[model samples]
Target: MTVAVGAPFRTVRELWPIAWPVILSGLVALFINGNDAFLLVGSSDKVLASAVAASAVQFVAAMVVTGLVGSSQVLISRAIGSGRRDRAARRADAGLWLGMWGGTGAGVLLVFAGPVLLWLLSGPAIDGDFARAYLTVTVAALPFVGLGSALRARLAGLAQARGLLFASIAAAAVDVAVAVVLNHMIGPFGVAIGTVAGSIANALVLAWFAVRRLPAPTGVRAPRATAVFGVSRGDLRDLLALGWPEAILYGASSGAAVVVAWLLSDGPAADLAASRILELTTSSIAWIVLTGIGTAATTLLGRSLGGGDLPAFRRILRHTLIVTLSVAAGIVVLGLLLYIPILGLFAPSSVREASVPVVWLAFAQVPLMALHVPVTAAVRAMKDTRTPMIASLIAEYAVFLPLGWVLTRVIVLGLTGVFIAHVVFWVVSVLIVGIRLIGRIRTPHTLV
Candidate 1:
């Protein structure tokens, strides 16, 4: 199903069919991260604090794994777009291999390093022991999570995202059921166990679909076969070159959030809880939409680039920006109208009250995020990750963190200040990427 990017309205209509399934899949993925907090919502403040802290730490690790394998989607999409089914299959296999081995190494390192890291990050308020316990269970399942990412990427790159939707639904069902059973059987630890179980289920289901979709390996073998598991040395190098920037980008962004949470740990308990609630809610909505749009952009732009269709690429980019910005505007309006009730659903009255202003502040940045997310994905689809990574570094480290520190700590602006700093980060990121994208568009012939 090749996309017709010539007509803007037709392109958008075509986009929705592809985007909705990926969006649903992203939502289900969020369930894996959010169910813990959802189940623990009305628990004691201490337990809620512990769960939030542990979850945040766990999220950073998960992002690292996902980022490391993210290039599979871009490479597979480009390969398929260029009509190289064999190469696409090989790249998929390489991603799976990397996920399995990389996950093992990461899990092992986390087992040893998690405690101290959690201790340092959790500060005096949060329960370090509980955080460490959660990390142990979830980290052990990193391989499964990593494998799931690779499979999902392969399917998405092939424009077979419906498979991911089914996998996500099944996995979410398992996650909720396991979380309930474990929560009753043990305690907060059940949430972590449930998360691991769900991740494994998700990976297994997606793997089944991915295997069926990918091409079978040819029997031909070179005189000296250097490839392992259908992936050559050059494949590994390409994956790394394309993937590391993404890893660093995800790590930096997540790390900044963790730092903000830690800084808030010294404040009131309500402040910390509210911050967590706000983060989860906003991220769930924003990321779901962003990921969906990004996937579409990646697939469409990748195919255009692969086919050397510069005009089509430009058309798709323009249409994507329009659709994504419209979506962002809608999210902003909906968030403003519904944030209070939504906050009430996940947080106690005290926490909700404390979080209202922060939620409003976050909503203000959605437009900038809407612009940044799809643009970044478009840039990545061109197989140029370094640009987005550099933009992220400057936005997070150079602008966001220092500003957040001064506002939250030095000037004592608190949560409000932290959120404002976040808005500033997005603004700068959008400017940098937007300018680069404009420059590329003007010279579309040179993009390839």
Candidate 2:
């Protein structure tokens, strides 16, 4: 369990024992999410636009929640790595407290912000109403989704991949069942509701396990939430240090995509649909490498560094990079090979032609984007989130959005241009993260 800084085991060899299960779980989760998205806008361009619009508000809520929830993973991973079981237990309790308040706050904010956000994202007349309805229902579920995030992060940091996987599979099945049934019955709104129900269910499952399996408080001690975990200045600082940047990066990325979507709103329906589908697929693959393996890397790296195993940490980093690169290449190949069929799943025949080109373009960029996960995760493992945040802002705001707007709106390359913009964005982000990681590697001291 105690690995040196330069542990001989390859990162893949080490990480696979933990990461593959997480990835499998993530795929199931991503598929459910993507399916819900597809259900909302499979046929109508306007509905698709609305779905994106609604998702914008949800994204903001997620960022805010993540700012709080993210702390749990870093702290818990450190505790676990150092074999501080009690501390890990305490942190898990803290995560629950954070989830309740943070999720509630985010939910309230979303309920109020939903209308304002929708209005801001409004395009043509038809799309506005659909967007409003979808956004409303989804945003209504903010508390559940936000809490779910906190729970998931805690479990992940504990290396409870199996539990997480089970929860995800259960959630996905329920969500899908509900979505299919409701989509037939109540239309797009039903799908959104079903998705929310799934999130709620997922949170419950995670909470149940965390409460039951973690160490119990002695009779002399107070309740877990009241006695063990409370918001503290230190906790806030630690959480904010890593979490804010991640939240900001995610918010910016999602926001940028929405902006680009708006820019090309007037393009052909097929093209727009294709762009959405591409985004969905890209997001799916991203979770597999970035979010999935990244979660594992973050936990492993955080733990190793916490235990003063700098060499082991570095080994983990190396292995993560190797695995990420392999996965990225795999995504590219899979993307290219499955282009027509994958796009077909989300688009009708009428839009298939235009969708194909945009999707292919998006697939071409998967490898670059894939490379970004390990670097970001590794840096986060070092508990230095500011660097990644600064890098993301520069890459996304300074480079990606501007170029996307130009290519898609001004230059009018339509979906294809949008795809190119995404590629450029990922390529730039990967480089930025890579450079930062190298700096960390060269530093004399190990960061925990």
Candidate 3:
């Protein structure tokens, strides 16, 4: 199903097929991550804190893997768009090898360094042992996380969104079942184990689907010696060149969240719990949509650039901004309407009450986030990742963190201060990226 290069509206219509599956898959993935928090709700507050803290560390590590996988998507999409299927296949294969090795290194590091990291972030309030135990299982599963991310990127680059949906649903089902059964049998630690199992299942299913869908390698090379395990020097260089900025982007953002969590450690228990629930609810919803829209932008714009259809690329960018903003506005309204009830479902009364203002403040940032997603995605699809990375770094470190600290600590605005800083950061991000995107679109610089 080749997209029409001329008809922008028709391209928007075509996006639904791609976008819906990606959205559903992303939501399911969120569910898989949030399952532990959800299932551990009725447990003690310390247990819940431990679970959230453990998951936070794991989330940062997973984002690092995602940074690497995102580069594979860009390369694969462009290769296929330029009618270089063999190149796409090789890139995908290289991505898989990178994932395996990267995950192994991450897993080993987490096993050794995770406890100290959790200790610093969680402090003395949460159960350090419980957090460490959960972190150990989840971090050890990084290999599977890496593999799944690479496979999903390959499928997404091929425009096979349905495959990702299938893999995500299967993983979510496994996560739910294991979390429920194991939590009953083994307490909170069971949730972490379930997550690990789900990661492995997700990776295996996606790997099988990717193998079936991706083009077979050319020539008579042995399966073992062929693209299945092939890793070239050029592939490594390209991946790193495109991927390192993304790693910094994700790592910095997650690191900021860790800082916030650590700051909240000295506050009330309800505030800590509220922050987690807010993450699980409002933030999760926004990220799911953003991720889906960003994936679509990458695939469509990468293809357009590969075909040398600058007009189509620009049109795609415009359509993505319109559709994503429209969707984000709708989500913002819905979140506002359902804010109390949504928090009510997952959190106790004290936590829910404390979280309401934070959720509302977060909702206010949605439109700005909507504006930022497509612009950054367009830049990254052009293989100019550094611009967005720099923009994000400035927003996170320069604007958000310091402002949040001043508001929360200096002025004593509590959670509201942190979320206010959140809104300001998005505002800054939108302006910086918007300016860069406008310059790129107008000046007609060559995409690297």
lDDT by candidate, in order shown? 0.79, 0.70, 0.80
Higher-ranked by TM-score: 1 or 2:
1
Sort the candidates on TM-score, descending order: 3, 1, 2
lDDT of 3 by residue, 113-226 (tens): 889998887664577888888888888678888888888888778777787888999999998898899989988877888898899889878876765543443221111225
Task: Show the colliding residue pairs in model 3.
Answer: none
Cα shift from native, residue 172, model 2 (Å) = 1.5
Task: Report the CA-based lDDT of candidate 3 relative to the real structure.
Answer: 0.80
Candidate 1: list runs displaced more than 4 Å.
1-6, 213-230
lDDT of 1 at 359: 79
TM-score of each: 0.93, 0.90, 0.94
Tell me which residue pairs clash in candidate 2.
4-312, 5-310, 5-311, 5-312, 6-311, 11-319
Off by over 4 Å in 3: 1-8, 213-230
Best by TM-score: 3
Residue 222, candidate 1: Cα error in Å is: 21
Error of 3 at 367 (Å): 0.4
Error of 3 at 117 (Å): 1.4
